[model samples]
Target: MRYFSPSKAVILLLLTVCCYCTSFSQTEKKHDVIVKLNGDQLNGDVLEISDSTIRFTYTGEKLIYNIKKSEILKITFASGRVETFNAPPATAQTTPVTATGASTAERRNKVAVLPFTFVKDGQNAAQEVSDEIQNELYALLSKHSGVYTVVSPRATNVLLTKAGITKANMLNYSMAEICQVLGVEFIVDGMVTQNRTTQTSYGNTSYSDKTKKNDNSDDKKSSGSASTSSTSVQNYETTMDMKIYNDKSEIVYNQNRKAFWNTADAYKNTMEYLVKRCPLYKK
Candidate 1:
């Protein structure tokens, strides 16, 4: 039989653990990663590259993610392959310098809120609501100083008119083209739907009461009552669906939210919620 000292046994155990850790680390590093310009790294295995886009399935996942070349900084592969990207210089300034020689304080993630499409019984009301929502979005986003740069409704309308894009044909154009024409890094487009409803209800109640007079006479009475009523009014239910796309035309956010209130409140509440929930809010 062989006997080993305690110190020797402990040394052997540590050596074994070191070797195991090295092996595990090598195994974990066997994948590719896409590093974005903003310093975000997406770990995955490169699946395909086509049309200035890289498509890949994230490590240990089946879902695929596609990234535009313009947005990527570099790509590192498991097999020790490395590729660095150099984005071309911008031809035009996204946010032009001001008279004071100070650049706009807004982040690079500029956005354009296009006119909303409305679904309502009255055409005038629908137009008014759409205009109201656009104005509300501009007001809310602009107040969040430095968080986002929202294009003014007037500027957006002018661009749309120049592009010959009316409410009826706005959907026909592609998101990428819209982004280009707007000179923005992102596009915010959505639809507003209004639903009106009338409801009626009825109720019945029965009770019995007994009274005693001072002369020791007792009186009892039973009564039953039933009532029915009807009400009719226009109750506006607003459903707003918003979509945000990047300069590459990739969908960054697509959310649907609903609110029941007057036109102004509906726009205010829904837009506030969506803006806060948006990933771009704090980015």
Candidate 2:
């Protein structure tokens, strides 16, 4: 065993004492919940505490948390006030805004279209299709009188990207947040699949005896002599779904349409067709 000199022993003791003090100090601190599910958060220390709740600051205001409703994920306390741990709830909490006449009138018959998402197949093609569909949908909505105002694609793009949603497989925004942000009565969101190729061939020419035995007395005529080459042109097909909601944010109508484009001039044919045929036009 190695023994330390007197000075070295004193230094070691001091270090041990300091570490013990640090551990003791950490165990005695407590922090109030700073942030809540809603947009509310505290900027200052918690001033009061109870078995089930704590009071924290607002804009020079103080608010109380109902321990039952307030999520307690993780908390470290100061002798009683400063906290520094995240308490993210496993689920979301919705706080509805009561409808006043002013609020009701302000949101009357509004609509917003979520930014279209493209399902990436390890290529940029999907994004292109997403943009193409979104633009066409916007153009269609632009001409309608029955439809409420559509949220700008730029804003939708920002929100969608912030959510880390890079694909159109689903809309990640919750109904509450979406309606809250856009103040809309309806939201139209869905995916877009670009051009597809389908081929059908009739009379695939072959040299089988059954196809060739047209019993010429002198010689057997091969099926290749009667073979015909046929080809069909494939076009872009699109399917669209639109959803309408009432003030309560309940979906009232879900409309779907599928349209086909002509092979010669139908790169974006499906989107144009939906704009013309969508019921939103008459409404």
Candidate 3:
């Protein structure tokens, strides 16, 4: 067995104490992260956690901050433990209860397509066209909606009718209210305008002339037959305005597109273009 003198034993004790302090200092360096409900993150030491508030200090600063637990979304501790705070209840304007009593939180990742509003020559056309566009849009979205549940047009229309939400009265309700009623996280609304741009007329004329007396004389009598035909084509210019809103009534996407072609059903192309580029669209 090795025996150390008093002075050497004291030195070894001091070294062990130094190593322990170093290890403790390294552990203390690890930060605790606080995530706020508004999406802000704070990195620092958590001094204390009270029932309603948390005491914290910035990583490099000594000034302590006391944050209400209600404002914090969660906290990640240095030891890899996570604590989450309850989210504040949404208000009526932000997350209204639906007819089925489902809250907006229950509508995550769901989408609803509303009946389009169609106008032709500055006058509101029949609702038949609006319903047609709605069905078409619903079909397109249902086919390509990645990670989103698209409510069928039939179901959406039924719900809207039950809520007394027609194209004329839709504007009276907030987007959040509409989304809640449809039980969807997002809603797609569109308006199509079609106006006659120009009328083009094309004609073709054909004439045949025969000189029977040309064999006898150069300036003999001549007979001619003529036929003419004309046709008129009407060209239209179409524009589509598309908007997407979340359950919070925030507009996530808004775009106005004009059809590149001048045809009667040009709005179809414009509508497809908007859908393909909207935020919910995925490869």
Candidate 4:
């Protein structure tokens, strides 16, 4: 009979323990599983639930993924928590704006839409955006009958110019000073911001090489090689903010909205959404 030494027994025990741990780690269960409406399953950890969206992270990956609630069928968590999503209604009810109007005394309030302040890197394009925002805001407000008497963009520009509000001196005045110069009890000021970014990624590559000998013989051969690749992704973001101030130079309403597209139509939609939600635009 062969006898094993104590040191040999200890070494064997350690090896067995290590092997067990490695096997357990390899077969560890997933933290959660997400079932998409399209019959796909994603195994990952559910990190957050907000904004009608779910943030999930795949096992062993640092990248986080976002899926809208509308796309998810259900989520099964490791701890036995299951969440289901119901399809959203096709048309949500639009509440009528019945109480957003000012009183009879307040209806006479005069409001001016000033040249928007541009927070950007370059001056040439910033000026254009500023002018566009000013024009759009004036147009929207002017169309709102009896909400507030809106000052025309042309007249507002003349008042600003006469007040020495050149590009050089525009940033030096306070909201009260601007209101005084525009001769209005309330004013609408805005800031426009745009951020654009791009990202590049590479996918798996495959290479193939082949060699053939000429039928005529000799020591000559020909070789051929081929390769394939994929494309990259690029994204952009833009944001705009609008604020309303009263005679006391206090903010009465403020809103900052952002969008992902960098096109003129996207900007227009953003402006529309923001303006529609303003306190003065109800009903």
Query: Which predicted model would earn the best lDDT?
Result: 3
- Residue range 81-177, candidate 3, lDDT tens digits: 9988967555433322356467756798999999888999999989899999999888877788899999998998898887877776666788888
Clash counts for the predictions, in order: 0, 8, 0, 1
Candidate 2, position 14, lDDT: 99
* Comparison by TM-score, 1 against 3, better one: 3
Better of 1 and 3 by lDDT: 3
- For each candidate in turn, the TM-score is 0.47, 0.43, 0.58, 0.46
Worst 10 residues of 2 by lDDT: 92-101
> By lDDT, is 1 or 4 better?
4
State candidate 3's TM-score.
0.58
**10 residues in a row with least lDDT, candidate 3:** 89-98
* lDDT of candidate 2 at residue 192, scale 0 to 100: 51
* Residue 146 in candidate 3, Cα distance off native in Å: 0.6
What's the TM for model 1? 0.47
lDDT of each: 0.72, 0.54, 0.87, 0.73
lDDT of 1 by residue, 83-161 (tens): 8885634543233221212222332567888777777644435566677778877777677736567889898778777
Could you arrange the candidates by TM-score from highest to lowest?
3, 1, 4, 2
